[model samples]
Target: MELNQIYNNAREKMKGYCKVCPFCDGKACRGEVPGMGGAGTGSAFQANIEAWQRYKLEMRTIHQVQNPSTELELFGVKLTTPIIKAPVTGSSYNMGGSLSEEEYADIVVEGSKEFGTIAMTGDGADPTMYNSGLEAIKQADGFGIAIIKPRSQKEIIKRIKEAEKVGALAVGVDIDGAGLITMALKGQPVGPKSKEEIEELVNSTDLPFILKGIMTLDEARIAAEAGVDAIVVSNHGGRVLDSTPGTADVLAEIVSEVGGRIKILVDGGIRSGVDVLKALALGANGVLVARPLIIGVFGGEKEGFKMILEKMTTELKKAMILTGCESLGAVKGNILRKLND
Candidate 1:
């Protein structure tokens, strides 16, 4: 079947939590609401809505061009596009569902194979998850990347060693889960840590490390200064800290502050290819999508995931064409046209 047909099929069949959050529950479950009685809540969710709207406008302007190429390189890995799958936790655990490690890994490997880019795995340093990842790594045909999250410095060291042993291409540290956890939410807990502690974790491994859940330029600069390989300017997809600024809002500042010293990646409420384009134009090396892939995964496993990747790359190529960008490098900060009141 054609890619769009597959996407629509998946979209049609997608139910339960697999439904689009922005469309279904975005109105009532809205964050940034003036009187929402929750911590880290309010407005951040609204930013996602705004981002999606802007994305639609931009994609409409660019969709009809021929040969919309979506090729880019990330962390020395040549990719057909800068778009990537974001890492999501509690998929079966925190989400009241169940997907075996092999099943999850297969979708990633297969999708990456189909898309000609690397897929990002979100399993942290848990022994069971790592073992599952190892099995998938063995079956994979050089079409993906793994970013294992460790709870502690020791776990980080062990996970990095394992990833190295598996010959994984890149490494990412989820500082978003670094230190403090509160039982105030229904989902997984976010661990907050100090720069010193995080620096120690980064220095623990020789692999290219990306500090995920970075929402501030100051933290991004710290990651760069510490010789980390990358920084995922993210808010844990708005799952961790509720009211954190959208990655797009602060992406340019982080990109400018980091000063090309290291690769920069951004994630959080990224649902489409145009979203990826906006991120790239605002100074991100690439963008990550997690929940959308989860929806795809729940809908049709590898096929569903592959459809999502195809959709984003297609739309991203459309954006590139209209923006007059022939290559990833051509889609620079100047492509961004901010709306001013």
Candidate 2:
């Protein structure tokens, strides 16, 4: 089916929760908690899109680079593209219950593997949400990453052990989930961690341990000092707080402070392969595509998801070629021209 058809199908299935807007921006669904909108004023969500749009690319066609490589290696796993499907849950309530948690995780894990990249599964207030992702990872022979919520220390450690058992490539905690009221509503409390607490958690996992949702250079440094294998510079898709700066707005500063020390992945309002190029130029090792994949999976299942990834990868390759980047390593901040510059 065409992408538009898939989107229509998803909109029909998801109904009130998500309108499945064409742009997937926060405009139509602002303040939509149970659906795909941002939190509070939705400014944070909008900021993500605006921040990326603020920068323009400088094209250079006078190059002999015939082929541009989009290959990326993360945590010892080789991926065709430096893009990973972000860990997302809430298929039940937030997504209108059209797709079960397990079904969604299965599509993402299998689809990502088929596309030569890995998917990150998410944790939710419900225990089954995480378990389903683990099962999917097991089915994928542990080619997935399971991101846990910032639960109690005991709970986080318990999930880490489970992730190891499933042979997950890496595991992490989206510390930004600490502000999610749904966790408390479900009786699973979550909160920010002290540096000591973060260090202890990192030490508990033998596998690569990532810390997601870091938006500030200070926190990025703390994560690096705490020995996290990587960090996802995210604003929790603007779902956790209002008026927070977009991930792109603060990514350069964070990367400057902790770039070589930690693998930096970014997400939030990344809708296209061109956006992915912008992210790489700004020093992100990888980018996460969230809402678009949600549309893909909900609309067309595994094939739908794969189609979106492949399209984005193709677009990224084209962007690289036009910008004289022969490989992902060659993409630099110079490729982007700020308005003032």
CA shift at 175, candidate 1, in angstroms? Answer: 1.1
What would the per-residue lDDT of candidate 2 be over residues 1-341, giving only the tens digit for each residue? 79888899889988898998878779888898866889988899999999999999999999987799999999987899999999988898788888889999999999999999999999997888999999999999999999999988999999999999999999999999999867877888899999999999999988999999999889999999999999999999999899999898899999999999889999999999999999999999999999888888889998888988988898899999999999999999989987751
Cα deviation at 287, candidate 2, in Å, is 0.7
Per TM-score, the best of the predicted structures is 2
Candidate 2, superposed: residue stretches over 4 Å from native: none
Residue-by-residue lDDT tens digits, candidate 1, 34-113: 11111244356456546544432333353344565577777676788787777654434333244666677667766775
Q: List the residue pairs that clash in candidate 1.
A: 31-42, 31-43, 32-42, 32-43, 40-242, 40-243, 90-94, 179-191, 179-192, 180-192
For each candidate, what TM-score against the reference?
0.82, 0.98
Give the best candidate by lDDT: 2
Q: Cα deviation of 318 in candidate 1 (Å)? A: 1.4
- Give the whole-model CA lDDT for all candidates, comma-separated: 0.64, 0.92
- Model 2 TM-score on a 0 to 1 scale: 0.98
